[model samples]
Target: MYEIELLINGRPFRGAAEARTTLADFLRHTLRLTGTHLGCEHGVCGACTVLVDGVSARSCLMLAVQADGAIVETVEGLAEHDGTLHPLQQAFRDAHGLQCGFCTPGMLMTLVELLRETPHPSEDEVRDAISGNICRCTGYQSIVDATLAVAGAAGTEGSEP
Candidate 1:
């Protein structure tokens, strides 16, 4: 077993895992952070997406040891400590972007990266940013709308014309 340490969701975490263990398994099984889901396990479905060192990554495709000393962000980190939703999360709820919710975490993390880089992304950019994530339930329009809503709110906040 290899000992791994990561800064997860703004907190430090340490655990031991086999060298071959995927980061998804380490997060879910060892660290008990179940918000990162596993689907397909081949890095195609994107359900196991997470932010590593501030970039979106497929957790299932990353080994636990490979992520040692990296900073990681999961869906659980999106909300405020006092239970307040992040703007993107609130927008998703308002826009009804999620149905079954299996893919919401990945989508949220992916968009989090996108919004950080492009605070006010166009509809096409939002769609392109999330193109890697596959959501079987919402058909994607709602998701796109939700991202745009968040971007729109950001664009309008504290702006004077």
Candidate 2:
């Protein structure tokens, strides 16, 4: 087993897991951070997306040991201290961007990275950014709309997260 220490959602975690254990496994099985879903274990699907050092990554693609010294932000970390939803979360709700909600966590994480990298993204840009993520529910347009709403520029003015 390999020992790893990481800062996850603002908390420090230290544990011993198999060196080959996926970050997804460590998060969900060990830490119970179920918000990081496992869509396609091969990383084709972005369902396991999370913020690794502020960039969106498929947690399933990396071994838990690889996350040593990394800082991760999962969907569960996005809420306000008072339990209020972040603007993006509320926007998704208002725009009806989810169906079964399985993909919502990944979508939110991806959007957070998108907004951080480009506070204001064009529709095409949004689509391009999320191309790796697949939503079988196919609520894509509304997801885009909701993302735009969070950026506070649904009309192409570009918004930031």
Candidate 3:
């Protein structure tokens, strides 16, 4: 087993994992951070999206050992400890961007990175950003609207955990 150490949700974590262990498994099973879902283990689906070192990445596509010394952020880290939602999350809720919720986590994380890079992304850009993530429920216009709403609102893209 390879020894790994990383910062997750602003907290340090140390653990041992097999080389083949997916980062998603390490977060969900080892650290008990279940916000990163595993919809498609093949990585086609973005259900396992998370921020690694400030960039959105597919947790299932990365090995746990590859995350050693990296800073990881999951959906759980997006809100304040007092339960205040991140602006993106709030937008999602207000715009009804989520339906079944299976893909919400991934959508949130992906948009988080997108907003960081492009604070005021256009509708086409929003759609491009979420192309990798599939939501079987909503028509996706709501999700785009939600992202645009957040982009248009008071900036909360840089909220700290």
Q: Top lDDT: which candidate number? A: 1
Q: How close is candidate 3 to the true structure, as a TM-score?
A: 0.94
- The full ranking of all candidates by lDDT, starting with the best, is 1, 3, 2
Query: Can you tell me which runs of candidate 3 are displaced by over 4 Å?
Result: 155-161
Estimate, for each residue in 1-161, the C-alpha lDDT of model 2 and write its tens digit. Answer: 98889998898988888988999999999888898889889988899999999898999999999999999999999998899998889998999889888888998999888888878788898899889888988559989998877776533544345
**Which stretches of candidate 1 lie above 4 Å from their native place?**
158-161
- lDDT by residue (61-111, candidate 3, tens digit) is 999999999999999999999999998899899999999999999999999
Error of 3 at 38 (Å): 0.5
Clashing pairs in 3: none
- Model 1, 1-161: lDDT tens digits are 99999999999999999999999999999999999999989989889999999999999999999999999999999899999999989999999999999999999999999988888888889889888899999999999999888888888894310
Better of 2 and 3 by lDDT: 3
CA deviation > 4 Å runs, candidate 2: 153-160
Candidates in order have lDDT scores of: 0.93, 0.88, 0.91
Residue 12 C-alpha lDDT in model 1: 98
TM values, all candidates: 0.96, 0.93, 0.94
TM-score of 1: 0.96
